[model samples]
Target chain A: MRNLYLFFRKHYFIFLFLLLEVVSLIFFFRHNKFQNAVMYDWTSAISGRVNNTYNSIAEYLYLRRTNFILGEENAKLHARMPQAIYLADTQIYIRNDTIMQSEYRFINAKVISNTTNRRNNYMMINKGIMHGIEPHMGIIAGDKIVGQVVSVSRHFSWIMSVLHKEVKISAKFLKNNQLVSVEWHGGDYQIGVVKEIPKHLIVSAGDSIITSGNSEIFPEGILVGTIKQVKEHQDENFNTATICFLTDFNGLGYIEVVLDMFKEEKTNLKASFQEL
Target chain B: MTNLVSRNIVRFFFLILFQVLILNHINLGGYTNPYIYVYFILLLPFATPRWLLLILAFIMGLSIDLFSNTPGLNAAATVLMAFFRPFVIRAVSNIPEEELGIQPSMRILGFKWFLSYATILVLIHNFALFYLEIFRFAEFFQTLLRVILSAVFTLGLILLSELMFYGRSKK
Candidate 1:
């Protein structure tokens, strides 16, 4: 017991220093910004209250700077959007200049409502008669034709999306001009069937289908989809081709509405011919 | 003993008030921030009990840390100073005669002796405090500069206060 006392007295300061240092280190790392914040919550009430008051004062002082910095960051993000001044004309070129047109004017509109699950699903856009939108306008999103405008209101329009059972758009094989009509199978949004392409055309999976422009609703060569599976029947002369829809109908955000001014004249001529 | 306790009690309030209210706000354009609260730890009675010194240092540091919201920084630094005070006093004073209760000041220990003693300890304390605050040695030179400037300012404040409190020439 005397020896233990001697040893402790001799090294008392060193032991105390180390112990207190460890305590300080515990506090240091516990409240460190890089560490998990929940570790060092054991603080005195008086100090905590004092810190709170100090922090409140500091917070009030820097609030204006914080707001300014946040506003600047937000403005930088907003500037990245396609600006009205940059895309000044109806003939707008987006990233990679994939779309450039004078024959067919493109009006960019936001998709307000959309669905891809039902037998005959439809989509609604935030454009209508007020924005020169009309029925039969082809809606395309980044390389693929999405749908056509079936009804128009004063400020909004509904689209008969290609996922609909009755949708039959004029599509042709990109490899060869083997014309086909695309219709949704109602089971999966990804798969759509192409009709009228002959089995003798040597159709296979991975073949790209594009717009034939036979309907004049969409321009020639607008992307339709890629062939996923070739369903051939011995009795039928035509091949039943399943193609993956290039446009993700479920993720549609903004789409371009194609307005062909010459469509009115073509419709008028067809109407007159029918009258005869 | 009574004089020592009462003096320390008065010094405690004054040092904290000076540190938190006045010195903490003085930002000299990112060049210097004089920490005057450390003066209390420096002037502690030289032959004071080891445990008493550490506890006093801890409380002084804790008070400042509470006000600033840096809970451990000042406490750690002050405790470090308390731990080293005896060794530093022994080294500079070179006199083991008064090992009990000699309050360090320019009046007690001549100007030159006190100058060297305070300068070294203050530098070490500031160095520990600043380095712990950043905890990164990658900016070693940058933090070193801040520590040096802050130490010099603190040292100056300590001397100025001493001159005011303890007369120029001790009778």
Candidate 2:
């Protein structure tokens, strides 16, 4: 007994270090999808409260710049209004032309806290479960696609920004409607990559990329970004295109989360295929 | 004592806020996010109990990781870094009898030695972090590239912080 006591006294710090490390490892290894759901659900409340306070301060600092961006976006929309009317006038003459169509809905909320430099960047918004925000809901800022809601509390939610590697959205060429998966390469916040565009399909610089609406998270035809560069892979059949994101995630302060009514049915159907 | 506690609390909150808001947002082009919050861990008063130091490091990392939602990644990195810190300090600094009781800082260890010690320890911390995050060897080269690039950026941020916090005075 005496020897055991002395031994513990001498190596108390070592024992403590080992203990904590063991606890951390256990936590890491034991975590599964179910545990993740519970953990995020618990932390979501704490984060909502903490982020609410931090976001208010951040909101104050970005007011001028946000207003400026909003003004510019508003002007661009107004400029397009005249052309939209011209097209509508042209469409009135032709009853069955479905080529010209537009589908978009914008929900505005202040960005409380946003991190772009991290390997997994996340943005918090003031809207939450209480405000119709839910997990997997698509998010947008102004005219550009940002990310999707990962978790939500009563009054706040977290966005898995496009800057993160975990973000993969179905995107396609606006002209040909060929679907490709857009994912960030963890290099630049402003640039992401669109994969699996077959080489035979014609691709060019400055092609517009839009959401494919395959996932019910986002409505089809949401503007993602424009393809800045297209590189033909040496051996692969697919060409990779670099996308220049329209929204500056670094300066983000406001965002809108899009909630589709059919998300549950669509997600369930998609998930059922994977389970088999 | 309460005054000191309150002052530290304010500083702690401000540091974390700045870390997540401003520093975490500065991408610098690639897989590099300057972990300035480790400065909080580095600046803890010398002679702080080993257990207390580890707990503080864990909490600091947990707070950031929770916000970032990378599971236990940051907490694991910070705890490992804290565990190794005292050993690193002892290995690098041959403390004189008079300076034996002092904790490490620019004043106690001098700039060159302090920086060397800090760089080595932070590199270890970041390497462990990158490896764990990848947690796979399939894309070894890509992960290695991320580690090197992130280390350089983190080193620059650490230097900038040292300059800002301690200025030119050796003490």
Candidate 3:
């Protein structure tokens, strides 16, 4: 007993170092991403303040640029709105009210903090549960899809940005509406991969890609990106290609979340199907 | 004792702010990222208790990690750096063990010694950080190149800061 105590005393420093290292490594190697959970949640209170201050100071510098982008988006929206509408088929009736019939509504929010350099990137936004924000809510910038809300606190939410390695945006070829997925390869923020496209499909370099409505998270026709290059996969039947995003992720300031009213029903139906 | 604690507290916030706000946003050429925050661990007092050093290093790295949203990568890497710090000190500087709180600085360790010390530990820290971040041996050479490049940038920043602040603040 005396010898054991003396030996431990002599090597106490080593033990402490080893203990801390192991704990850190455990968190690193843990299959669950704990750093994005509790510790980060605790910091939301602080970083939200810091990032807000920094962004407000820096916001004035880019007034002209932001105004230009916002003007362009407004012009595009103005041209796209349904200016001519007819009360088609007087006999046909819709159950929901005219204003509330749409399953999704846009919730405007400002990005407080964002990053595009990491293997897996995430963004923080100013909206949260109090603002009707929740996890898995689809986010977009103007007409371009950005990311989805991953976790939400009372006043803040973390967006798993499209540049993140683990994020897979359900997208499709705009030309044919063929279903596909957009995935980040971790090197560049502007480039991502279009997964599960058929080899038979003629995917040219500049072909536009947009979100597929198959995924409950994002609505159909949300502009994802355009193909930059197409390459044949190891399986000759399938094709994978690189896509360049339409929205400049590094320039994110304002974004909107899709508050989908039918998300619960869709998820429940999918779950029921999965049980088979 | 109080002086040392207070000084480190200030340094802690300063380094984190510089790292997240400035160095992180640099994103040179879209590949190499300079991480100067590891300087917190690098400049810790030589005779400081190992347990405290390790915990402090973890907390410091974790703080930066939380802000950057990289999760545990920095915490793991800085912990590893803390584990190797004592040996690195012994191999580089033979300072007496009686000194309780003489923090590392270019003026005390000399420019040449301080440069080597910071370079070696920064290399180790970056190695652990970038590798664990990608977590794949398939891109070994690519990861190695990034590690070296980021280490060089981090070393340059550390040396520049040392030159600017090291001698001016001493009693």
Q: Compare the candidates by DockQ and give the number of the best one.
A: 3
User: In model 3, how large is the Cα lDDT of residue B56?
Assistant: 91
lDDT of 3 by residue, B1-171 (tens): 798778878989999999887777677657668998888888777667888888998898888877776656798899888888888887886666554237788886678778888888998898999888878786688778888888988898888988889657563
The candidate with the higher DockQ, 1 or 3, is 3
Which docking band does candidate 1 fall into?
incorrect
Can you write out model 2's per-residue Cα lDDT over A76-149, one digit (the tens) per residue? 88887755556635645554536543333456898877776555677778877667776777897766788887
Q: Model 1 misses residue A19 by how many Å?
A: 0.6
> After aligning candidate 1 to the native by TM-score, how far in Å is the CA of B22 from where it should be?
1.6
Residue by residue across A1-276, what tens digits does model 1's lDDT show? 999999989999888887777777666565424121222223323433443355456556556755674576568757766662476674444434334335678898866555553335666676767899877789897557999887665566667789764579998999889889998755467888888778678987899999998897898889989999888888987778889988777666668899896788898999999999
Off by over 4 Å in 3: A26-41, A82-100, A233-235, B1-5, B93-101, B169-171
Which sequence of candidate numbers ranks them by TM-score, best first?
3, 2, 1
After TM-score superposition, what is the CA distance of residue A251 in candidate 3 from its true location, in Å? 0.4
lDDT of 3 by residue, A94-148 (tens): 4557655787899999988888777767888998889988888899998899998
List, in the given order, the native-contact fraction of each candidate. Answer: 0.27, 0.44, 0.52
Interface RMSD of each: 21.6, 2.9, 2.2
- Where model 1 places Cα greater than 4 Å from the true spot, the runs are A32-276, B99-101, B168-171
Error of 3 at A242 (Å): 1.6
Candidate 2: segments with Cα more than 4 A from true spot: A1-15, A22-50, A72-106, A267-276, B1-14, B25-33, B96-98, B134-171
Candidate 1 local lDDT, B22-109, one digit each (tens): 5765654333478888788887766678988887888788777655545577889888988998888878876455542357778766
Residue A61 CA displacement from its true place in model 2, Å:
4.1
